[model samples]
Target: MKKLVLFVTMFIMVLPVRADEGMWFLMFIERLNHRDMQKMGLQLTAEEIYSINNHSLKDAIVQFDGGCTAEIVSKDGLVLTNHHCGYDAIAELSTPEANYLKNGFWAASRKDELKPKSLYVRFFVRMDDVSKRILSKVNDKMTEAEREKAINEEIALIEKENNEGGKYTVSVRSFFQGNEYYYFVYQDYTDVRLVGTPPESIGKFGGDTDNWEWPRHTGDFSMFRVYADKDGNPAEYSPENVPLKPKHYLPVSLNGVQENDFAMILGYPGRTNRWMPSGGIEQNVKYAYPAWVESSKLGMDKMKVHMDKNDKVRLDYASQYAGVANYWKNRQGMIDALTKHKTAATKAKAEAEFNKWANKPGNKEKYGNVIATLNNYYSKTNEKARHDNYLVGLLRTSAFAALPYSMGRGLDAYASADDAARQQILPQLQAAIDEYYGNLYEPLEKDVLAAQLKLYATKSTGYKIAPYVAKIGAEYNNDFKAFVDKAFETSIFTTKERLGEFILHPSLEVLKADPLYLLSNDLIAQYRAKSDEQAELDAEFSRAFRLLVQGMREANPDAKYYPDANSTLRLTYGKVRSLPKDKRNDAKVNYYTTMKGEVAKYKPNDEEFDLPKKLLEMYEKKDFGRYADKDGYMPVNFLTDNDITGGNSGSPVLNGKGELIGIAFDGNIEAMAGDVIFDKDLQRTINVDIRYVLWIIDKFSGAKHIVDEMTIVK
Candidate 1:
């Protein structure tokens, strides 16, 4: 352990600490980061935070639904996560008569707790450094493909040997752009159930307008309970299963946050590319994000028109709309923030410095041409990148093309099945088709498909189009609506009834002959052709990227280097603070927001700011209960400098004493560039104060039963 610490510390000894940057590996924290954290008021030791030999903080954290972080808060395995993390589950449970999304839901008792069809939480078992094992099987002389195959083989062997007969999910992930590797083992619990949630008016307060902005008052949290078998082991969901007895759970702290207080967050951060070259950043900003933003906006606009008018439609498409809107806003922020911060120019300057170092003395052989190679690849594929984005957007978001492709494979399967097998699987296939059409709106989709097809046919970003494009031009005179009208008239995928009629007497030839299916097949073929053309360039870029990351570290051995996040459990510590307010904005930035601010933003019947009448009465009465701070106001949300990204949503924000004070939810808009390059002065993590969460659960919702389950520290 000492030796490992020394090796990590040696690399970062001379590095300047810029706003306490780094998403550090837990295993190395005791030796490499404990002292710095302690100086910032950390009261827990590294082992106490992440010991494998004993139950520690690690046992409390979980990978929620394979995408977000969640933590156990009670002895009975009560899990806490972002409201958006549980959005799909809540939407699934919703109905026109009882919309849990509009009005909040609180399971009055354990029996009332609802489990979604599929929801799971994974607990981290352990992680191991397997760099030497992976690197031993390959040499520098090996081609990139050969090296990848050899490494994968080695990783499979390691995972197989350590799986303990499949009791845990084991896999290896590359870190620092494949300069290092680590193996992780996790045990998943599949019986997670929803316990409580506030309404969208609170949970999704401010909506898209306040999503990534500060002064946030959104009570963005939801609750769940993890269940286990009779013996307290992980098991499938069953009525007989009982709430799990967790190994450890966080003690919630009611102590309010102050300016510059110590803060820490631990979670599975999805991904970041702090080591990306300037050329890649430019390509994303200039080519990729614009198409993504435009397509997502168009999809959201169509969904909103239907959702606003019909309650059933709103419930059916709520989760999907939120997902699209989140990224639509995020991509815009990324483009604006990156360009505003001059990230590409900064990266270019640094790349030049690294290149200078690489060309000096003995470094040339190992690192030569890495920068130029990466730049050339990005430049050569710039137009193709935009074309691919536009194509993917049309196929994925444009349901006319998307549904056929998604359901076509299943149709083909049914066509090839024997009579006995077909009878057995027919019901399942019918159910799937029913589910797809249940949420689909043909009128809206037809318009969307027509618009996207017109764009695809007219766009000059790419060199080739799907084969069906020629037919649209030659036969329909480039009239996308005319082409769509004929396809919908003939394709079984246009309506659920048509699909059902075709399924009654399935034919492989007829299915293949359908215009929509042919279009789907043609789109796939075009995608494959483009992929094949770029295959070699992609490989070259990958090799160059690996070398670039390694060369940067070698060139600046004395600078601190933390591996980019790859959805692995990590700890990032810092302090509570606010960024300097932009001159263009009139509102003064505050470190924390309160219930007063939430009320101030309220609109009586507005979709984004509507407040429940009961809550409005409570607010008018100033009935904050016992959760109000010393100043006699209920806290809503706060800001922290703790380094975090997308997957860190719902991660516990801990005080120096290792007590949960808040839940990390979003990042500030000005620092959207942080994922590409950490901005010391701008980046800030937005968190929902735990006090606000508890207040909503206890006072507003009247679910004191939940308050009784937690270990509260006043």
Candidate 2:
């Protein structure tokens, strides 16, 4: 423990902090960043940002639906997050007769708010380092598996210790490639309900064509309210619950932004690999991401064919379609940006320099083979990486491909249960079957699965392919439609009714002989299959990676570093910034965009670029309310240099006063390689200005009551 503290102190003393390059830990704000942040125009003290004993800015932020960030905006628990973040919930609550996703909906009063089947928001309570305690349980002499087992045992105790007898949710997360550990405490409220949203035409204005691009105009915000019992403690959904009065809420700032003004973002950033080696980068850019892009596109194309022709089917698959399209574009962008910037070569050069230091006297025994092990592992797994990504596409997009694993496991358990146990599990299995069939549109699912199977079987030739799929593909002349069609026609798992009949007389032999189940089982087995040699290599690779990160820190004691993001609460600060002048951006400067540019992209009846009639009329009339800038234009979106990534969506983009100025939504296309490396000059966080969010809610949607709930700062 003493040694660990000394090493941490040495690391801090040598860090030459870069203002715009790190996702900082809130707990270390005072010791590591407060002074630097103040120099960059922060007005509040570090204690005001994160305080365990008092209500602070950290109290306002939440992990929305366990994926994206959100913030409390009102004393009544009005929560704000990105439209796409709330997309699944909104779609779930919508129907053809009352399509809230298409026409938008605002709760006229508290009783009018709509609740989805499953939704929750988690507030971060605090975090503390548990590294020394965890690491003390393992040593260098232990194998990786032994080390992992020991760590897991300790982690379970740590979580139990902090959970306060089930009142709080606790997670022990590893950082710096498992060199360090921290436990986060959070409280979750399950009775969250949708408050309001704009029409799809406005909420998703630019859609796919404009995603991850600058000079954008998308009102990408959604509102929900958290409810709790009268005592303000977490509880399940019930009509007796009321709006939660939160510990803190951010005041919406209408002061707007200009270039160089101070801006910061706080959120749970998902993941990044800034310390990844050159070989790993090469594998992703050259092999894995390309397969992911191609397979995702194939699935999207097949689904869209049916979605375009039927409204019910479109509604059923809306959320799934959006998720696939977003990643498809993102992965392709990553490939382009990483290749264009030669990120792999850059990492390789750095590795060469580190290798020299690694082989030196005292370091030779501990770190000499680290680089070789990593390189050899990546080289050997390159083809498998590509193969796995293609299969990942199938599992993500095709329900049937994953069903045999997800549902079959449940059935296997049920079949093995005794009579008394079966009575308890029968109802739960029925509900699961019902839910699965409820969301599925058979024609769309069939088409997508067939197309993806064909694509995967043909493109995954570099490694061992799924035997069942391969055999069926060859029998069908590499076309899987007829085979998939026949399987769907005969498989009991294809429909709720057939599955219900099977539940009455469960049989393991029937499940094993099922065509669809056989195909799905083979695909899953192939993906998980690993030779003994390969398994050993993987374990060595993990150990070597951890050592490489630790060795680099020791070698370059003067360099600055932050742990890579792993879905933990982080803060990043910078300035309202712009990119190099481009003909594409219609803004006067590239720092911010206006309503005029959004209207310019509008098409009368197009899906992606369509605009509502009321929005058009308001834009033409120049009926800009107080939400407009002093120059008489409605600010739509703005740019900032705050380092962010995927899970940062819906994060509060706050001004120096800790007031909400905008909501972080996307990153620029030029910096899509940001997960691997940070580019201070080109990387920008795209935010929908807070004023635009208010205007849509109060003026366009007539939800003035919602605005009244917030403390608006002008």
Question: Over the stretch 1-714, how does candidate 1's per-residue lDDT look in tens digits?
Answer: 964544444333223366378898899898778998999989998988999999989999999999899999999999999999999999989898989988979999999999998899999989999998888888888888899999999999989988899888997999978889999999999999999999989999999999999778899999999999989989999999999999999999998899899999999999988878889899989988887787778777867887888898788778878988898899899999999988888778767766766677798887878888899999898877777777777776676676787788888989899989888878888888877888777777777777777776666346567778767766887898898888889998988888888888899998999988888777777777846548788888888899887876775566656788899999999999876654423224478887878888889999888888888899889899889988888789989998899899999999998899999999989889878877778789999999999999999999999988999998
| Candidate 1 residue-wise lDDT at 621 | 92
What clash pairs does model 2 have?
A: none
TM-score of each prediction: 0.95, 0.97
Predictions: Cα RMSD each: 3.8, 3.6
Most lDDT-accurate candidate: 2
**Stretches of candidate 1 exceeding 4 Å from the true structure:** 1-16, 424-428, 528-533, 581-589
